[model samples]
Target: METVIEVQGLTKSFGSFKAVDHLNFKVAKGEIFGFLGANGAGKTTAMRMLCGLSKPTSGSARVAGYDVQLNPEKVKQNIGYMSQRFSLYDDLKVEENIRLFAGIYGIPRPLIKTQTEALLEKLHFTEERNTMVRALPLGWKQKLAFSVAVFHQPKVVFLDEPTGGVDPVTRRQFWELIYEAAAQGITVFVTTHYMDEAEYCDRLSMMVDGRIEALDSPQQLKEKMGVASMDEVFRLLARKAKRTE
Candidate 1:
């Protein structure tokens, strides 16, 4: 598989503090890569840089075939992002929200209608298209947010704690959507605290403080650490962090 994301000696500093230190990794196209860490582990800072939302203090990264620092706009155009806080207008109707995002992504006006219809049908939300987003259940909103994120067919989608605060069944359903997206050749880069969610990724990187402490498939990490589950592996790694939330 081709590399969709490449990072080399990536670092970010906030005055006297270094939020990301000498980070390095690559994400393969169509792969589901999980980024796991405890609170304040610098995952958010690293992702912000990768998504072109923040500038790196040193080093370089290529996202979706564009240098993040030199071509942040191009990087933004090729990727989609779903934040942990759920970025949708609560006052907007389902169809309205989809249209709004379509415009933001620069999807042609002529194609927006067709794309919106297809998205609604795919998520089985055609019946709720006219309803306000705030009226939908949390799970439905989450799925809708994800659909909107990928409506423009980005090369990669950054999901920042996409399953947070959802029920187990809903999280499972969300993971199904992720699998479908990955199968269709979209790279999925996700950060999640849930161990079970971490296990679902093709591979995972666990961050401690501002650096990655371990990177491997979940099963491999568990085996390497002599643990039987991701929860154990995460606990073991998290305990070594020098920072705390």
Candidate 2:
């Protein structure tokens, strides 16, 4: 498979605090790559660098085959990012929010309209097109956020804790949406703390203390660590790291 994201010795810092320490990884085209880490494990910092929202203090990365350091604009054009606390204009109607996001991407008005119809239909949101965004349920809102993120048909979509705070059923639905996107050849790189959610990805990288301690398919990681599940692997690793520290 082709490489969609490539990071070598990636590092980030907030003053004296190092958030990401010498992180290295590659996400292949059409793959759903999960990033698993506890809170403050530098997942958000690494994602920000990949999205071109923040410059890495050291190392280099290429996103969608464009150097994030040299061509941030180009990288942004080819990537879609959905933050954990993503906001849509509450007063705006569902379709309105889609139009606004599509406009921001510079999509042609005609194409935007067509894409909007298709996306809403795909999500069974056509009935709520005229309803206010704030009136939508949590599950619907999460799905809408995802639609907006990839409205411009970006090559890669970065989802930072996309299913945070959602119920189990809704989370499963959200994963279905991700699967649909990956099936269409769009690469998905998501940061998530949910061990069960990690199992849905094609592969995962588990981080500890700003460093990647394990990277592989869920089954492989489980087998390597002699754990029955991802959650156990995470706990086991976290405990070992704590002991070392």
Candidate 3:
């Protein structure tokens, strides 16, 4: 497969603290790549750098073939983002929010209506289109946030703890949306603390103390560690971690 994301010796520091240290990894097109770590394991920091929200202190990264530090605008143009908190305007109606973001992503004005209609129907959200986002259920909001994230057909989508706080069924349903996006040729780079969710990735990188302790498929990591599940693999790696959060 073609590589869409590449990182080499990526590092981030705040004075004496190294939030991300010499991280190196590559993500292929259309792959679901899971980034797993404890809350303070630097996953968010790394993600911020990759998403061009924060700059790296050293090393390099390229998203969609553009250097993150040198061409962050280009990188941003090719990617979409949805955070754990579900980023949608609570005051805006569902259709309004979709139209706002579609416009932000530079979709043509004439095509927005046709695409929005298709999206609303596909997600079974037609009836809710005029409803305020705040009135929607958590699960429904999650789905809509994800749908809007990939609406512009970005080459890569960054999901930061996208399933956080949702019930198991909702998480499963969210994963289905992720699968659908990947199937449509969008690369997924997700950060999550959920062990079960990690198993759904095509490949995973386990971060500990700002470094990747293991990077492999879930089954391969389990087998190499002489473990049976990702939960076990995570527990063993996190046991020696200094940062608990």
Candidate 4:
């Protein structure tokens, strides 16, 4: 496909601390790219920059063909972002939340209704359309949050630790939703602590102390580290970091 996100020498620093250092990566259209790292590894920082929510202290990034620094608004328009914490009005009915976001994106009322119905049915949330978001279960809320994020048909979706607190089965279901979006030509950029979820991604990058230490398919990363699983690969890479430090 096409290049949905491009980064080169992307760096973000706080005082003397480098939160994200010289990161370089590309995500292609319709691909699910995983961003993996332990806490404080700068994954969030890098993601924030890519999503146009934060600026890089130095270097550059482009999202959906718009330069992040010069055209942050354009970049935001073409991308959807879901944080680990769900961002929806708890008191609003599910459909209302959808309408609110649709309005925020300036979508026409008729198109909003049509798309909302289609998405709710496709995601199996149509029956719960009038229910309060606060009453929904954690898993359902996560799904709704994701659906709302991409309701505008954004070219790229950025999910930051979306399944962090979800159970394994729920996480799998969430990944299924992610797969559906990717199949429909939306690029998925996600950060997660779940190694199994990492395995589901088309490609992944592991960050350490603000820089990427490994970038590959999960299977390839395991092979390179002589490990049996992504968890092992992460452990081995982390150990290497400690030794060098």
lDDT of 3 at 166: 92
Model 1, range 121-229, lDDT digits (tens) per residue?
9889999999999999999999999988988899999999988899999999999999999999999999998989998999999999899999999989999999899
lDDT comparing candidate 4 with the true structure: 0.90
Worst 10 residues of 4 by lDDT: 236-245
TM-score of each model, in listed order: 0.98, 0.96, 0.98, 0.96
Report the Cα lDDT for residue 118, model 4: 93
Q: lDDT scores for all predictions?
A: 0.94, 0.90, 0.95, 0.90
Tens digits of lDDT, candidate 3, 1-245: 79999999999999989999999999999999999988799999999999999999999999999999999999999999999887999999999999999999999998999999999999899999999999999999989999999999999999999988899998999999999999999999999989999999999999999999999999899999999989999999988799655
lDDT of model 3 at position 236: 97
Q: What are the per-residue Cα lDDT tens digits for candidate 2 across 1-245?
A: 79999999999987987889999999999999999887777788899999999999999999999999999999999998888995678899999999999999999999998999999899999899999999988778988999898888899999999988899999998998898888888999998888899899899998888889899999999999997988898888776454222
Count residue pairs with overlapping backbones in model 2: 0
**Candidate 3 — which residues are off by over 4 angstroms?**
none
- The positional error of residue 156 in candidate 3, measured at the CA in angstroms, is 0.7
Candidate 4 regions off by >4 Å?
A: 242-245
Please state the error at residue 147 of candidate 2 in Å: 1.0
- Give candidates' CA RMSD values in order: 0.8, 1.7, 0.8, 1.8
Error of 2 at 179 (Å): 0.6
